[model samples]
Target: MANGIPLDGGRHAGTPTVGIVGLGLIGGSLARRLVARGIGVVAWNHRPHPYAEAERDGIRCAATLGELVDAGPDLIVLCNPLKAMPGVLVGLRPLLASRPRITLTDVGSVKGMVRQQVEAAGLGDRYVGAHPMAGNEHSGWQAADPALYDGALWALTVTPGTDYARFLAVARFVTEGVGNRIIALDDTTHDQAAALISHMPHVVATALVNTLVADPDRNIAAALAAGSWRDMTRVALTDPERTRAMVEEDSRNVAALLRAMAARLTGVADALDAYDDRALTAFFALGQPFREYKARERAAALAGAERQPEERTLAIPAEGWQETLLASARHGERLVCLAGDHTAVVTAAGMD
Candidate 1:
C-alpha cells in the first residue's frame, strides 16, 4: 500500500525517516514508533533543552526548523499545541521554499483553522490535517508512547486544496506505521463532527462533575464515587488550556449541542415531576443501549496490542435527493439512522 511514494525523495527505498516539529506526546510518540520500526527520525522542539531528551532516546535532534527541513525527512509531523500553530506557521513559511518534498500532517485536535492556514500558505498539496482520537491526561515528551496510536480512529481531513494522491499515501502511512484506522472527511465537516462528539462531551463532563462538587455536601458525593462517576468525568482531567481552546474556538457548535442537552435534561425533570413513570422508564431504557454501545466501541478500539483494520468509507445520508446521489457515488451504501427526530413516534427501529 505504500505504493512507492517516497516519504523523503532523496532517500532510498525502505527509508522511514520522519521529522517531528514538537516533542509533546503526539510528536514524541510518532518518533518512537518510527524508530521502533527501524526508521530514522529527526525531530526539533522550540525549547532547546528538550533536544537532550530526544538525544537520550537516540532520536536525532535538529537545532532549527531549517535543520529539520534540510534533513530531508519523508514526513514532517506537526505536534505543537493547537493554539501555537498559527505562529509556528509564520516561522515555518520561510523554510517552505528550502524544505524537501515530503508529505506533511498535523496532530491538531481542531482542523478548520489549521486547514485554513495550510491553504493560505500555498502548501495545501503537501499538507493534510490529522487528528488522532487518543491522548492522556499528561502532556509533554515524558508521556510519549510508541503504541499510543494503536487501534485509535484518526480523522484525516482533506480540504479542496489537498492533493488526493498524497492524501491516500498519508492515510496508508498512518494505518501501516501508526496503527490507526483512518476516517476521511472535508475540513468543515470534520471540525463540526469533532465539536459535537469530542469537544462538547468534555465541556459537559466537566460541568456535570463541577456542579456536583459545588454542593456544601460535596464530600458526601465524593464518598459515593464509583466507576461510573470516575469514567464520566475522566475527560475533565485533560489539559485545561487545550480543552479551553477547543471549546472557545468552536464555541458555536459546542454551544448548540449544550443547549440541546439542557433541553433534554429539562424534559426528563418535567417527566419526573409529573410522576410519569412510563416516560422516565422509557428515557432510562433509551439511554441503556447507548451506554452499552459506547462501552463496546471503546473496548473494540483499545482491545489488543494490534492495530484494527482501516475503516475505508462511511457516510450518513441526509433525507434529500442530493444526499442520495452523494451516497451512491461514495459507494452503494444506505444511511441507517439509529434514532429518529426526538418528537417522532417511538418505534423499535428508533430504539435500536
Candidate 2:
C-alpha cells in the first residue's frame, strides 16, 4: 500500500480526508460535520442500515474494513468501544503495515490501555489517542448531530515519544475543522482525569438511578423528580452495554474514586444525622465557589468560541520589526517569526 495518497485534491490542498470505522454517534456526527466542511470521508460501519444511510448521504461507505483502508485516508479514526479497539488494531496491522505516514486516532474515553495496545502492535508512531469530551445520553447514528462537537474539549494523549508533526496535524483538524478545543495530556494523566470527571460520575449517576428505582415509592418519587435529579442522572440514560464496556475498561480508577465519594457521602450523612449546622454550612459553602468557577469557565469558553482569530502570514524586513509588532500587539494577538527570509505570521485576535 502507498504510504500517502493525495485526498480531496493535491496532497496539501483543500481539507484532509479521513476514514472512520464504526458509524456510531461520534463517528456519524464527525462524518456529517466533515462532509459539510468539504472534507472527504470514507466510512465503514458494522451495521448495514447506517452504512446504507451513509452511502445515501454521499459519504463513501466501504463494504469492508480492507476497502476502507484502500480508500487512502490521511487519518483513520477508530470509533469503536474501548474493549473492541485492540482487536480492531490487530486486524488493521496487515493493511497498515506499509502506510507509516497515515495517522490513526480514536474517540475512546480511556487512553492508557489503548496507548499500550497501539505500542504493542508497533503502531505507536502512527497512532494518537483522542477523547472528545462531548456527547449526549443518546446512542447510535440516528442521534448523531453535526454540531455535537462544537466548543467541546477534545483531549489528545501525547507522550514524550509521540510524533509531534502528526499530533499537530490531527490537532489542527480537530480544532479548525471540528470546532473543539484541543487539550493535550499524557496517557496516564488523561486516564486519571477522565476517571474523576467522566467515568466516576457516570457510575454515580447510574447508581443513583438504581437506588431510586429500587425504592418502594420509586414511581411516586420519579414522578415528583425535578431538574436536580434529572440533571444529575442524565448520563444514566446512555446505552447500558456501552456504559458497561467503558466503566469496565477503567474500573480500577473508577472504583477508587467511588470509594472516596462513598466516604464523603458518609460524612455528609453523619452531619445531617447529628444536625451539625456549622459543618453543613461549611460543606455547602465549599461547593459554592467551585460552582461559580465552573460557570465562569463556561462563559469564557463561549466567548472563545465567538472570538476565533484568523491567522495571516506577511513578509517583513527584519526580525526586530517582528519583535516590535509582537510587543505592541493586544492581549489575544499572537505573532510568530518564521525561519525563512523575513517571514512573520500574525494571528488577529479579539476581532469579531
Candidate 3:
C-alpha cells in the first residue's frame, strides 16, 4: 500500500486516511509517517498546542475528539499510556454507535488489560492492541520522528473478536511504512514476553543505577565504571513513574520474573559468601557465551529489519503441487514441503 509498508500475502494496494488520538511521541511519529505516505492524518491532543504543532508538520489538527472521530479516517490510533486509556475509552465509548467505520488500535505497552477494557466497553471488533518496541528516555513531541519506528519490533496482540484481515492491514501499514518488524502475539503471550524482554530489563537497569547513585562511595564506583556499566544502566534514566506504573499494572508477571531473578542473585551471593570458587567460576563462565549469543541475535534482528519493501513476500506452494510454481514464484512466493509429520510447509522467497 502507500508509504512503502509491505503488505501481507493477498493484500491490496492503496493509501488510507488515519486519525490519531494523543499527539505524544508515538502518535506524532505515526502522523508524520502517515502524512509522508499521502495518507490523510487527522489528530487530536488534549493540549491545544500539539494540534498547532502538528499543523506545522503538515498534519491536520482536529479541534476536538469528536471532530477526529467524525472524520471517518480508515484507522484511529490511540497512543495514550495504559493507565490513561480507560478514561479515553470512557469518553470514546458513547460515540461508538455513532463512530465512523474505521479500524481502531492503541499503542499501549500492555495488552491484556487494554484489550479487556476495549471489549468491556463494547468496542470489540474495531479495536486492536499495538505495542511499538521503540521509545526514548526523553518523552514528548520534540522527540517525535517518523523514523522512530525504523528497525523496531512492533507487537500486535490478537485477541478474540479481533478482525484478522483488518488487523493484518494495520500491521502492514505500520511495519512497512516506518522500517519495522511486525510480530503477532496473543494478549497473554504478549504481556509475558514483554515482561521478560522489556519490563524486567528496565527494572534491572534502573536498580543498577539506583544502587550506584545511592552509594556513599559513588565517586569510586563512577570513576571505575566502563562502557559496560554505562550501557547496562542507560535505561535507568527512563521515567520512574511510567516504569512503576507498568510494573504495577502487570504486577503478577513482573513479580514472577523478578522473583526468579532474585533467586538467581541469591545463589550468586551465597556462592560468593561461601568462598565457593567452583560455583563462582561456573556462574562467571556462562557470561561470555550469553553475551556472544545476545550480540548475534541483536545483529540478526537488525539485519532482518534492513530488508526493503521490495523484499516483502508470503509463502505459496512450489512446483509439482498441482501445476507450475509460476503463479507463486511470479508473486515472489517460495515453497517447501513439510513431509515430516502431517503438515504442509511453504517458504516465502522474498522475505528473509
Candidate 1: the clashing residue pairs are 7-74, 8-74
Residue 297 in candidate 3 has what lDDT?
59
TM-scores for the candidates: 0.79, 0.81, 0.78
TM-score of 2: 0.81
lDDT of candidate 2 over 1-352, digit per residue (tens): 1222233345533333788888889989988877776677888887668877777666788888888888888789888766777788888898999777679999989998888898888888888788988789888899878889875767777676666556655665675556555555677777888899888999999999999989999999999999999999999998878788888888899999999999989988999999999888988887776677667656666888675446666454433442333232423334332323344455543322
Error of 3 at 285 (Å): 5.2
Misplaced by over 4 Å in model 2 are 1-16, 297-352
Clashes of each: 2, 0, 2
Error of 1 at 124 (Å): 2.4
Whole-model alpha-carbon lDDT for candidate 2: 0.74
Q: What ranking emerges by TM-score with the best candidate at the front?
A: 2, 1, 3
Select the stronger candidate by TM-score from 1 and 2: 2
Candidate with top lDDT is 2
After superposition, candidate 3 runs with Cα above 4 Å error: 1-16, 275-278, 285-352
Backbone clashes in candidate 1 total 2
lDDT of each: 0.69, 0.74, 0.69
